[model samples]
Target: MPAYDQTRARVEDYFDRTATKTWERLTSDAPVSRIRETVRAGRDRMRDLILSRLPDDLRGARILDAGCGPGVATIALAERGATVVAADISPQLIDIAQLRLPHDLQSQVTFHTGDMLDPKLGQFDAVIAMDSLIYYTASDIGAALAALEPRVSGPIVFTVAPRTPALMAMWYAGKAFPRSDRSPVMIPHAHPKLMSAAKSAGVRRMLRPVDRITSGFYISEAMELRP
Candidate 1:
């Protein structure tokens, strides 16, 4: 297996080559109308969930989305009247996201090419990484939590795979979804120390739920960074 850093770069490259196609692939199995509704609903729910955890009003809050992928969440925040800065490592993904959004809403969302570990991002009322943080190592996750700590003025919501060694071993060793570029075969392993790092970083709210919503590959949680 490739080292985490190398694999991270490889995964980014893989997405860059296939970002436009990836969204289509992810939505292919479902009905087109249902897919749209699901995605919109999911993004709205995520926005509400994140905003509810915040102290500042979200009507015009400045929100930053790290590794925003195709920018669905970024667009959702913008639609909710937020000033969103969506950053991704892949410019191609950002392009697609930009194209998907409206011209007027375009002004509300500024897409940038950047990584989570970079120090140039400055700060925001909330920093949401969604599923992108799965690309980090234990130390990387810790560093990410710490890096966003200063920038996070209100809350930070992130998701990851399960933390159990058995699940991690299975994902790292088996393939869940056949014929998917996602390498259903190889998935990121969540670290136990992440919870500690989050708490130490002043995260007051934690939601850890292991269920089908995660597609049975891992558990999904929302860590609310308080203060």
Candidate 2:
């Protein structure tokens, strides 16, 4: 199989097996309320970063939440009155996300299970792929952006694992560490590579580190793409 396909398969498998645990980790660390509080606060910061980049009022906007895991951001967007289509490659995660929606808010969101590169996804007023680009290499990132470019009428917001010495060391260490539930592959891309991809896709882009984890070992960056 191709390297990108292999990486994608590993990511799907990893998330499929750990969907529930991952969702729990997002809201709570468990066995410690303080840790849970911290986790929630960090999640809010990331969510706010995405929201701040979007128009202040999204009541009539149509949004696509690419790689929407467990419907966290998807639900948030729907609650803000944006018509949302949430898609993920992992079926388990999509199912969990679907279950998380309230009955009244059901009409505001639709869910799909497939790769982000799938062409039938159609277009949207805006697109957000939170923390999902970490699985792709530079070339794969380019291809994914190419796929998403025409589909977005406005900005495309996504997060990537920044490429820096300290961050790269942490990524390698995570790979070296023994873990029963780890994915087979983990890739990080440099900001320049991502910008080049956006440029090739005929979009203007800007990036900034929105959050730091482990004191620089891992930084979450937010990138905005505009036509």
Candidate 3:
């Protein structure tokens, strides 16, 4: 089987077991609407940062939301008049994303289940993979990015966590968090090196901070990929 399929299976199992609990934790601090509002606030900020860094405008652009869990950000972009394709490895998550959208926004958004690295998605104007690249190794991440670049006519916006001592401490503190891996944890993304690798793949880099509290986290840098 392809590595994407294998990773998909692992991620599916991880979410099947932990999604409910994670939802509960997120919603524990706020009601559903409030949670959405808070998340939207952060997402809008990240989107704005991406817009500022990117050379092209995303308004009315075709967008691919890679690993778009629950489609929160996808729906947000759709609301802003972007044609959005929300793709996730988990069908269950895609279903949730579809159900979560209103009829009008649903008309503007399309949800699909597929591996992030798959080349069959055709092409898009922009791609956004927020908080999703942590599931792969460095080589896998590069492969995924390479597979993604041709599809993007404009730029790519994604986030990666910095690998620092403070970040390592945070990961250890949250190590008990549910994981599908039966073996050692994989550290796939590193911020400084990721920018270098992306540059090698024919994408110019721009980055900024994403302001959200994530578990097992370090500094989250929002990246802009210019071709």
Candidate 4:
């Protein structure tokens, strides 16, 4: 299987069955371990950073919130006046995301369960994948971005695990988990290397690094590929 497909399969199973409730709680107001709390906080900051890159007025915009785990980002986008297609690999997570979305914003968001890059989801004005692409190899990520680039008129905003001492330590620590219990392995990349890989894979737009968010165990960098 291609690296993206392989990682997507593992990610689907992990989030759907193994870690569904764990994530539900983490994304919710429910209490969690200090470590996980940091992760949640970091994700909030990353999401905010992603939003900042877009225009302040999103009215009439069409956005794809790829790998929208529990709909937090989807709801936020809807609140900002953008019509959002929230897509994820796990049906279970998609259901949670749907249920978590406020009724008032119901008309602003649509939910899809399947590939985040599915062309059938239709073209989009912008695409935001948040932390969803972190588990793929740089080549796989490049290919994934290349596939979406043609369909998006604006930027394809995404996040990747940055090559850093803390993230490396976490990657090593994650190896201690039993194979059946662990989440997909995270692949870290530097921006320069990632840009080269994306270009080689036929991604025409420039991949520019926006910012990095680090709160305890969570370390993700945001980037955008614009036409």
List per-prediction Cα lDDT, in the order shown.
Answer: 0.62, 0.73, 0.64, 0.91
Query: Residue by residue across 1-227, what tens digits does model 2's lDDT show?
Result: 27668778878878877655756466433453555555466556777788777887799899999988888888889888999999988887887788878889899998999876676877899998887877778677766776777778888877776676766786888788676756544466776777776566554444344444332223566767765
Q: Is candidate 1 or candidate 4 better by lDDT?
A: 4
Best by TM-score: 4
| Model 4, C-alpha of 79: deviation from truth (Å) | 0.8
Q: Against the hidden true structure, what lDDT does model 2 obtain? A: 0.73
Question: How far does residue 128 in candidate 3 sit from its true spot (Å)?
Answer: 0.3
What TM-score number comes out for model 4?
Answer: 0.97
TM-score of 3: 0.73
Residue-by-residue lDDT tens digits, candidate 4, 91-137: 99899998899999999999999999898999999999999999998
Clashing pairs in 2: none
Prediction-by-prediction clash tally: 0, 0, 0, 0
lDDT of 3 by residue, 1-227 (tens): 26645766777776656574454334234445554655545545655664444434356778888878876677667867788888887677777777778898877787778766567777888888876776556556655676677677777777765566666675675677655344224453566676565556554444334443333322455655665
Model 4: per-residue Cα lDDT at residue 106? 97
For candidate 4, the 10 contiguous residues with the lowest summed lDDT are 1-10
RMSD of 3: 4.8
Model 1, range 42-93, lDDT digits (tens) per residue? Answer: 5445545654554443677888887777776777778778888888877777
TM-score versus the correct structure, for each prediction = 0.72, 0.83, 0.73, 0.97
Find the number of clashing residue pairs for candidate 1.
0
